[model samples]
Target: MNDSSVGQAGKAATVSARISPAGGLDILSRNEVARLRDVSGSGLHGLLRRCALAVLTSGNISDDPGSMFELFPDFDIQVLQQDRGIKIELTHAPAQAFVDGQIIRGINELLMAVMRDIVYVSTQLEQGGFDLDDSVGITHAVFEILRNARTLRPHVDPNLVVCWGGHSISREEYDYTKAVGYQLGLRGMDICTGCGPGAMKGPMKGATIAHAKQRRRNNRYIGITEPGIIAAESPNPIVNQLVIMPDIEKRLEAFVRMGHGIIVFPGGVGTAEEILYLLGILLHPDNAGIPFPLIFTGPKQSAAYFEQIDRFLRLTLGDEVAQHYQIVVDDPAMVARAMVRGIDKVRNHRLDNKDAFFFNWALNIPLAFQQPFRPTHSAMRELSIRHGRPRHELAADLRRAFSGIVAGNVKDEGVRAIREGGPFDIDGDKDIMQALDALLQAFVVQHRMKLPGGTAYEPCYRVRAG
Candidate 1:
């Protein structure tokens, strides 16, 4: 195998060996193999390798993708065409991914998920004659992505609850999430999340116990991640089904499309990013009557945290935005009960409207929201977070601003940009900027921006009051 390394230090540590794929990605046509192996332009070989490496490093808590690349820069993956099926060829893979010389089955499965999504998106939508120009085309793309990943469950009822939270959280807050998840589990609801640590792992962990007691054998704990954040936040072991989307936009789309309801646990910027994303969509005039349930909950200690988020939302997006989500602190049972009731409404709405339970095909997602946000310096600067226009449109712009902050906080590209230039400057209406700055500063002070006990988190973004 020719040498392949992400950096100079990673060159010598590269390895070359043939490793087989697990379940969903077993068979491969010659054309499919060619698509995976092709490097010049049309192939998804490089993307596949990056995602696979992130899977191989599962359970790692580092939030810096660059560090992982620095350690295994020479790592590469190839899809080999086998008569029985497809085999994975690894070069310079990490030793941690294996135990007693046998690669962990979960890691293998997750790697297959990476390959599954990459190949499907590239061959089917990106180049395979799928029109992505219109709103309907974009929604179709989202549905197709989940379908190929085997994430859609047509036979199942509308009980999948998507949990949105930060990957970095406190011990008490994380424990509270587990408690809430247990209650949701007792009610027989499935779990879905970004599949990282902190609040995401807590609920999945607690649900396992409730599922055991309830004798629910078929439990679905799904994790959806994008390449940019995967290396920083490894997939928790509880994720039975893992799907890595090509970009953050698609990743967010997958969450809103497949899940029946949403739960927001106390978290930092990432959590705020999620909150803004859904609120923006729900605020859209077309979706005003939809029955999606959103909850912001935490332990007793986190009441103030959610309160701050609530106040900021009210200040920036207005009071009507609060009508879309409820904040319930320190009560797991109440949170679960509220979610169950809300989901029941969702079921009835879907039934009445003739929408699919497996995927929310009826939900209106503007192409503006579906298209990827690059978070470049210029793009970040250009975001309009001022007060005015439609509330939903303003919410969308605010979501983009936070998204830029999220990228700067942990994403490799955002971090590199900060290093090359300076912080991303966000200028907006005076009151909004002050409120936004206050919320972010509170996050930093609470040590919510990074994993607790690690190095102090730096502000990658600067908020300027215009």
Candidate 2:
């Protein structure tokens, strides 16, 4: 074992030990183990290290990925292939993950999930196992990934609720999310989220108490994230079932497919990106009459936030888009009842259509939404956020615009790009751009753009209303 002190001035102590998998990731081929250990620039070791660190430091409040790395510069993990299956060797792991020198059981399970997903993606998806060039193939790939992770269960009722919101939000909004989650939990619903703090954590936190009160067991608090954003927004500790998709598009797809209903709380660009993604799909001509339920809710203080979001949707996508979701305010019981009713509708629809309760196979997600949008400066500049296009198509572009801003705000690569260049240049239709600008500015003013009390946020993109 190598002894290396990490943290500033060695103030944060570390631990070294070999941990046996808690069951989910007990086996790996020799080649897979080798890939995880390869420390070259083109290898998976660096990616593995980043994700492992994020899991170890679960419940961290910082959105900066670099800060964690800075705190644990010498931390390392190794996958050992043994006849008895596999073991993880940790070097200078965060002391927080350990209690009395033993890694926390929940965190250990999450760490195994990290290794499981990285190895699975490297061996299955990145290789020629699945075609990623077309829409059908991408959807199939997402299904297979969830299946491998054991997230898809047969013979289960449709009770999973997908909650989308900002990781950075106000205290009132956070408490409101928990209240809604509690209400949902009391009704026997599970939760799925982006797996970060603030809104993501609140619902799961609230649900636990409700589940406990109802004596429910094995309630799933699933968290789906991708490599690009996972470090910035680490998986919250409440996520018992965690799956790391290969990219944001797939991660978003996972949420909609696996969830029976969606409840959106107050959030920033990331939440907007999710709302647009779902709205774009629902607005597609082929998806008309689908029974998926979507709700936008918050404390009474967040009424303006939802209003701005609603106005932005109506202005950009037309009033038809507003039909896709309902806005519920301050009443957790009402939100939960509405969600329960919505899930019942979804279940009946699936039964009538002979669809599986576990996945939404009938949703017509266009190739545009399925395709990954890399928020490069050039791509951001090329986005067409204007009128006269198909409403769904326009919604797709708007989603990309917000997605790029989310990247610039928290994603390491996007942040680096802004530092290297300047804020992303987003120029589009005059009216739409103005609405978008106003919405984003409100997020900044409300402290929704970043975690509360971290650092002052500078604009990541300059919106030009043409």
Candidate 3:
């Protein structure tokens, strides 16, 4: 790596370097390279630059998506096609990503992942490689993307656990996540998450220690993210294997289809969106027999948080929805033990059905759940958050409601919309609206809506009980 300090005076310190690709991504087609270099509105360069910068500044904590760009105004990345392989050129990149002018190995690989996924999605998925219009095609696309990233491990028993929680969380809750991860690691389980800070990083961090102590090698710490959320929550350093899905919908599907079990920590609307997405699928009549383990756990202090989630879920989706998940508060050991037992069942079920252990191909996901729901103000108002619809269908729309709030809170496009058109209007059944309003109020009070110490959060959506 050839790098030089381009920072002068009090400006943000940065380095310029040309480094070889790492982590098996050594080549790119000329067309792909050109597309990555293109700076037009239709080109993939903007997406590439944003995601590359996010990984380059891996440990920074700021929810504002544009802050990084504002801080590093001159940063730019270009793919240089070479006779040997591809080389990445960095201009005014974050100095922290380097030590003695050498790029950090993990960040380098993650940067490669960013390039790999962006190029794949733009050239392959969008260029008639995937029939994104249909449900099966979308699932197939997801599988192919993960396969391309080399994330699928064949012949391995079901052990990958997808942990979902808010980046913005309390210290106690974050530590509790680490403890649970430590136990899961001790049992030889791998960790997968959104690849951000706080809850997403905690399990992976704890698992590293356990893996080291247990003499476990070739352990996987996977982090799955999409382009929109990556800027707000940069990928944490603990993620050894990083995969970027095409969209939020695909990202959620990847979690359910890839992992044997899911452990949800206390979080905000983003976490709520994940819960509704999974439960909605599990509640489907076809998926009723599936033995996927869903556990909601946090420290004792989070009992009330779980209670609020429980009430909202029960009221909206009916009492039977609770059958899909188990709630265990204040016990990391119990959570790990329960997850282990649940994965055992999942393994057996996969065997009985002749399904692969690496991917849950037997599970049914409807087109509604698979399709991306862009949260424009109009779309937010159109969501049918009512009582009498089928439980699964209602859960899908309710998931959209929270998903819209998540977009409003973090995504750049959604934030600009909210700024221009005022907070999104979420109107629904009187009881459901009241419940949703109360839940969001609690998130605000607990500082779960944004990273702590940031500017006070303004309401991005207004709830109305119609």
Candidate 4:
């Protein structure tokens, strides 16, 4: 790494450096390098800059997506072609990413991952290699992306646990997530998350120590994220393997497809969105036979929070929805034990069905879930969160509703649109609307809507009953 530091008269300290690609990526075609250099509004430079900045400033605490850009206004990256491979050139990068005139190895790897994913996905789409129009085609695209990232382990058993929760969680809730993670690590389980702090980081944090205690090596700490959410939930430092999906829908699909099980911790609309996505897929008649272990857990203080979620799910999706998940409060050991048992069943089922251990190909995800929802105001207003429809169908729209709120709360485009057009209006069945409103209100009261020290969270969507 070549490093140069300059402290502007009245700006954040800046560093300029050129670094070779780390292990996650090494080479890029000349065409790819040209595209990376493109600065047009339609090109990849902006996206690359945003994502690379996020990696360079890992462990950032704020939930505001634009804050990093504001802080490092001149931060930029370029791909330089070389006979051997490629090297990255950064101008005014964050100083923290370097140590003793060298870039941190982990940060360099993550930066390469950002480049690898962006180039591969863009090239594939441009060449018509990805079939995004149909359900099967979309699933294939997801698998291809994971394969490109090398996240799929061919011979591994069912052991990855995807933890989903809000980055803005309570101290108590964060500790509880760690406890569960510790127990999971002790049992030889690997960890995967959205790759942010709070619940996402806690489990990985706890698992690290436990893995050490058990003398486990080559343990995987994977973080799956996308361009839109990466800025808001900057990849936590513990994420050794990071995969950047193209969008939120694909990111969620990656989580379900790659994880053997899931554990939901306390979170706001983002967490709720993840829960609804999985439950909706599991509720599909086609997926009823598939066993994906899901558990919702937290400390004793978080009991009321889980109770609220349980009530909402039961009321909206019916009591049968409870069959998909188990709630374990204040018992990290039991949570881990239950996950292990649940995964054993998953292993047997995979063997019987001849499904790949790395990915859940047997699970059926409809196009409605696979297609990206832009979360425009009109889209939010049109969601059919009512009864009489198939439970899975309703769950899909409900997930979209929460997803929009999450965008408004954190994503750059969603935040910009909300500011221009005002809060989204979400309307559905009277009972469903009331339940949704009550659940959101509780999140605000408990300060789960945003990080504790950040500015107050203004509601991004108004709930209406009709």
- Once superposed on the true structure, which residue ranges of model 3 sit more than 4 Å away at CA? 6-10, 451-453
Worst 10 residues of 4 by lDDT: 1-10
Q: Is candidate 2 or candidate 4 better by lDDT?
A: 4
TM-score of candidate 2 to 2 decimals: 0.97
Clashes of each: 2, 0, 0, 0
For model 3, how does the per-residue alpha-carbon lDDT over 396-450 read when each residue is reduced to its tens digit?
A: 9999999999889889889999989999999999999999999999999999886
CA-lDDT, candidates in order: 0.83, 0.90, 0.92, 0.92
lDDT per residue (tens digit) for residues 334-368 in model 4: 99999999999999999998999999999999999
Show the lowest summed lDDT stretch of 10 residues, model 3: 1-10
In candidate 4, stretches whose alpha carbon ends up further than 4 angstroms from where it belongs are: 451-453
Worst 10 residues of 2 by lDDT: 1-10
Candidate 3 TM-score to native = 0.98
Better model by lDDT: candidate 3 vs candidate 4? 3
Query: How high is each candidate's TM-score?
Result: 0.93, 0.97, 0.98, 0.98
The TM-score of candidate 1 is 0.93
lDDT of 1 by residue, 1-466 (tens): 1222221335433334566777567887788789788887657776677677778877777777767677887777787787788778777787676654567787888888887777777777646555677878777777787888888988678999999887777889889999999999999999999998888898999999999999999799999999888877888888989988778877898999999999998788877878888898998889879999999999999999988999999998999899999999899999999999999999999889988888987778877778888978899999888887788788788888888888987787888898898899999999999999999999989877863237788788889987
Q: After superposition, how far is residue 84 of candidate 3 from its true place, in Å?
A: 1.1
Per-residue lDDT tens digits for candidate 2, residues 1-466, read 1233333314567777788888468888888888899999868999999999999989998878788877788788988888889878888788888876778899999988888888888898557887899999999999999998999999999999999998888899999999999999999999999999999999999999999999999899999999999888888989998899999999999998899999999998999999999999999999999998999999999999999999999999999788899999999999999999999999999999999999999998998998988888999999999999999999899999999998898888889899998999998999988898999999899887864246788999999976
